[model samples]
Target chain A: MSTLQGAGVHGAASWRITRILSLRWIVWGAAAIFFLNLLGVIAVVIANSFATHWFGSWLPAGWTLKYYAQSWQNYQLSGILVVTLQVAFAAVIVSLLIGTPAAYALARRNFPGKRLMMLAFLLPIMVPPITYGIPLATLLYKLHLGGTLTGVVIANLVPPVPFVILVMTPFIEQIDPRIEAAARMCGAKTWQVFLRVLAPLLVPGLLAAALLVLIQTVALFELTFLVSGPGSQTLVVALYYAVFASGIRPAQAISAMAVIYMLTTLVVLVVTLRYVRPTQMVGTVR
Target chain B: MTLSETPVASEAIAGPERRSLRHRLADRGVDRLLLLSLPASLFVLVFFIYPSIYGVVLSFRPLKPVGAFGNYTHFFGDPFLRGSIVNTFRIALPAAIFNVLAAIPLAVVMRGAVKGQRIINTILVIPISLGTVLVADGLLNYLGPNGWFNRVLMAAGLIGHPLQLLHNQWGVMLSLVITGFPFAFLLTLSYISGIDPKMESAAATLGAGPWRQFWHVTLPLLVPGLAITFCLSFVLAFSVFPSATMLGNPNGDSHVLAVAAANTAFQQYDFPMASTISVIAAAIELLVIGAVLGLRSRFYAGTTTGKG
Candidate 1:
């Protein structure tokens, strides 16, 4: 009878523990609800883009693919797509060119005013684009570079270079310095030490940083929007115009444009995740 | 004998001196690598730094032909322009607080060897990739007057009419949360993951319950990081431009600081006023960040990670 009473007490304690732990369940449930809502948001766009008629109903009345064609022709999406690709690629290549070597120096060297230099680099990333973009855009227009692809590319480059430095600094720091020492000790020149020993190890980091920057540039709207002209508008900017333009076109066409933009970013994002964790991009706060 | 002795001393000193100079240069690898930082530095100096300084200078020259500080006086004098700052804070603060608060629990759970952590992270980051434009577009349709959200509510007999979810403050707030939450979650995860789990384990060994362990041990360690996450989130939300214009009624309730700046520059052709507004927005953003960081130092100011 005493042992049976002990078992009952143990059951009561276990039940209390579970009740306390149900807090975790609440957290997960909230997250799940949020995730479902996001999916629904995206789903509605996709469905409406293809729908023949999507009034207040559980589903669209019918489905079609002609909206994509209408959007492409109406918006001159082909030219915009080309410009988007060119700007994204150009920005990525230039940023990596300037950023990688700086990241290497930052990781390896202990120079005077290094902390100040770092803060300088961090400033551009911390300050929002719209904050500085206005003056920059004004200056670009004054210099005759605004309303051109070059202006957009230059404006977009401001953030990504610093971003590459921040992301790659830690990656370069993770590398053992002794490899460079060993290479030098083997009678390798400084350039040789960098090229033969460091470059191979740095490739993965370079790839990851490049891809992340690429994804950012593709999605980057403010800088591009501020400087881009009618002829030079990127996909996102063009989509914005289409959505807000006089209501001659159907909603389906605008949704179609949004879907295309989504696909472009999603493709790059999927590729980027393979190279780097999403947290590492923004979490290089320190 | 004196001349020979002087020559011998000179040779001895010159040989080692030249060799050591080269040795020092080589040892530091200062030949060309550090100079590589110059190009990137110059690029930022010319593009980022110069433009900001130019903006500040330009703000002194208003188009309305007044004093150097005329734009500032005008901005403060006008209720509509000044109220944009208040409107921005209204949207940014709550969204940022909610993001950080919600992210902490999720980060704590994910810090462990949790299942589907990667999947959850990927799903959360989708809004970031979608960018503000698409997110605004999606939210408009999904939460519109006849959207599925209201449909479900009506089907359940919860409300008689579709709730006004768009063209107001709520629309912008929702968009900011959706886009900004991933950033908060990711930053918090990195920070919480950085904290040494050994501290929590030790607390548990000493008979501390999970809640007690979190409050006493983990919470103190996370204070600095959470502060940073909140600041970053606030900055992003405070600079709301496209979403504020697209989702919210930009002409009235959602007339954020960015909209004011954009209109001053593009619409009114008042470049100086636009620059002035942007500078003000940036200053406000910095003030909030400074305040939070000041608060953070009082909470916990030490090594926040195992790596440290």
Candidate 2:
């Protein structure tokens, strides 16, 4: 196929074939451009975070570590990081607690209204958070639960619970039902069966789901932004406020905060990637 | 055997006489396991479904306690408020389209064996974890008039002046494309890779060229997945909030509906009005999703893979 047939193919046909093959080059070129820009977006932040000063130049004038320190103090990042971790871990625990059971039931049982129940789990994942987040925030505020860690945790729980259910449902299904039946036949109660048989088998799936939820909660901006108060701001929200606030914060400080946020989520994401397929994060709906 | 048989015999005996709901459900292959889903169902009911319904209800009640449709009227009557829908579409439609379009060729290329596939995927997925806020922050620095993008272009003598990439509609669009592309790409990759490769080989044996094979064998099987991908991406882009604010002129060209809704709720302290805009935004989003999915049904849904 690579060699153009000289005997039968005319000039136009050969040229067309050559052009089509060159499409590969075109594809690679576009991809390269995309990756370059993406890297630039990330690299520029890391660069500016450590730069002493930067203006109309290719690189920062000089590099220093002071902005990271300054941003740590100026943003009260220690408190913000604690809140972020609290919200993330809380979301993971609460979501796993509820979602894993639903996933098990959905996987093992085919009751009436099963489709509707699955749809209920799916709606939160399918809908963008901002649409539901506004009302969710309003509801939380009306209940006087807004502007607190509990509110932030509850708001973040909306997506991951469904996420866990969807993700773990398949994982649960992949486990042999005969194993469960054998455990049940051995005189183990339902909870005992879950504890002894399912839990051990489900640890990997659970850890992956929990880590995904942790990464999502850390990266999740809209829901937390809507419900969180001044003190309840996660790292993402705090970075947003630092950037959005009126004061002319040096670009270095904001970039430093962004780098910190990036590191936190990326660290969790790296762990998540270890257990879960990257495609699973987005394609769980299918 | 009798011990197991005895339970079944007793259930059979108990099935007809004074059957309670629990017995009825158990007879139909449901039992306490089904009940396990109740907590999650209740949680979703209270937080997700209920809030959505409440928001719709609240939209009808404005802050001033006027007529039922006060907030809706207020939203539609104000030109600035109403124009945000148009502005949002202006940003969202293009971002979604570009993301899906750019994703398709790359997805097709990456579906087969590629070198450093894991590393490539890791790099691609990084922006996702970085989130939009960081992406916007990064864009402001990298694509700002004085930043490296313009600097590099200047050094190459590409233009006389640094282009206005940020603080405009273009900046928001750029950020959306950067963030939205990975999502579209991953979804499309999964969909495309799910297709059987032998279909293309089959087409090739019939004297079809690469383009012919893709057009006839691949694309027909891919349309439905693409439609869904487009819908999902469109929904995500339609709700552009943080990036639109940070990268673009929020009050001017980039005044998306989300920004308007957020501003109403937070800045103006009008929760009802915010709910009104949120409802409208959701309605519009659902309409698009429905229309796309509806169109997808027109395509052949026999099987996703070409094996069938």
Candidate 3:
């Protein structure tokens, strides 16, 4: 009996050890993949920027900052960055200005066809970008707005406005309505109540929404590619043309620019996540 | 008698007039709010609603303005275009299956009490925010014939020549997997975490092993999440454009509905035909989403808990 008990104890101990090892293995494996994917892209871009020719080798044969130096000397990199920043900033501001009021209206008031309006706003997100890109571009061209930065910004607004509204509505809903009512009772006007009472409470949500919209606008490809002209091409669209239509050298330069854009976006997203949780924005969707 | 009657009549008239003025002011306040929504409302109507309706109408019209129903007829009659529709379903369905299948094990492994979960989560989510262009670019550099994979294979003496991965359907598939898997995995992980651990432990105590417990208890509970994840990932992969264009040969066998529509509208300037294809794509997407919603309602018919 004692021998049988001893065998059982040994088996249990082995099982426990295996379980622990497996769990540890899984954790480390996930961590390794995460680092490889995230850091790997950065490493490739950095390596390509320096190497004259690194094909067929695990590591580059040589390294220099010549590509970065060349990109700056030509002014292509700075020009694209300026345009990207301008378009993304304008798009985010417009989306926020338009979306906040709609979000407030949806959250605060009981209006007719509220559900229908909500669906209308979300429709842009549901349909594919390709479906709208052509028609929107055609329509913009007809209006003489096509091939302009404003045109690309307008096209981008469709997604960002709805996204902001979706994110901000919950934030607005969490603010105590009674505070607004009390403000009214104290003789504050409707606008005053919104400005003084509610806006402060929604500061985090607003920042989060703005950052999200900005990131999305900067990363957006299809609509911008379809609508943007030579003068208005965003960095992403520019990079795309450089890679596909142009030669490898320009593609490398563009990739270097893309790395900068991606890194900036990552920084913004991390900051946003730290300050404003997605759950706070999208958690109450139900 | 006349003077007294005049004074009373004037007072009565002023009282009614004052009440009507207040009503008008209240009405004006409501009207102003409605007016404030006008700009946004008009924007949506012109940009979103009109384009969508135009797409639907264009689908019915011929590419050459022959007549209504011509373009759709052409789409249906041409075996090549018709084959694209089938190809779309083939790609989207398998991608959804593969993504969901991969998500389960990845989520299961990640859910174990482990350190660095946050870092892993961040890594998984990074691809999602990286957008399709970057993902495609990375895959191109890594998986292309002259890229890392082939180089490694050649060095290892596994193959005499480089393998062709880019400019093929599999290239698009790999791009989709890399981009799509993170979304499915995250959704499944969040869902699985919400499930009470006691149920699994109870199954374990009842002599069921981990695999069996997962297959019976955990999998059943995960159905709602699986359905939603499948639909979401399928919708995303189905409407793929940048990846399809950059990674695959759109003019060749890889032309799906979105690519075909883009070609018609942009390349040919045939808006009607393009619109028609988009409308059809939208309808198919709606039907799939609707079916998933129906399944969700059926599955949760008697349950009180909400499934994300």
Point out where model 2 deviates above 4 Å: A1-7, A10-17, B1-16, B19-21, B301-308
Tell me the alpha-carbon RMSD of every candidate: 3.9, 4.6, 4.7
Return the TM-score for each candidate structure: 0.93, 0.94, 0.85
Enumerate residue pairs that collide in model 2: none
Query: For each prediction, how big is the interface RMSD?
Result: 1.6, 1.0, 3.6
Task: Give the DockQ ranking, best first.
Answer: 2, 1, 3
- DockQ of predictions, in order shown: 0.66, 0.75, 0.38
Native contacts retained, all candidates in order = 0.70, 0.75, 0.26
Choose 1 or 3, whichever is better by DockQ. Answer: 1
**By TM-score, who's the top model here?**
2
Chain B alone, TM-score of each model?
0.89, 0.91, 0.80
Docking class of 3: acceptable
The C-alpha local distance difference test score for the whole of candidate 1 amounts to 0.89
**Candidate 2 lDDT for residue A76:** 94
True contacts kept of 3: 0.26
Cα lDDT of model 1 by residue, A218-262, tens digit: 889899989999988889888877777827799999999999999
**Per-residue lDDT of candidate 2, residues B1-308 (tens digit):** 88889999988988776568767778776887777888899999999999999999989888797799888887889999999999999999999999999998888888878887667777788888789999999998899888878888898999889899988999999999998998999899999988889989998998888888888788888888899899999999999999999999999989999999999999988988999999999999999998888878876565444546
Residues A147-222 of candidate 2: C-alpha lDDT, one tens digit per residue: 9888999999999999999989999999999998999898899889889998999999999889888888889999
- What candidate 3 gets wrong by more than 4 Å, as runs, is A1-42, A72-75, A248-251, A278-286, B1-38, B109-114, B153-161, B193-218, B302-308
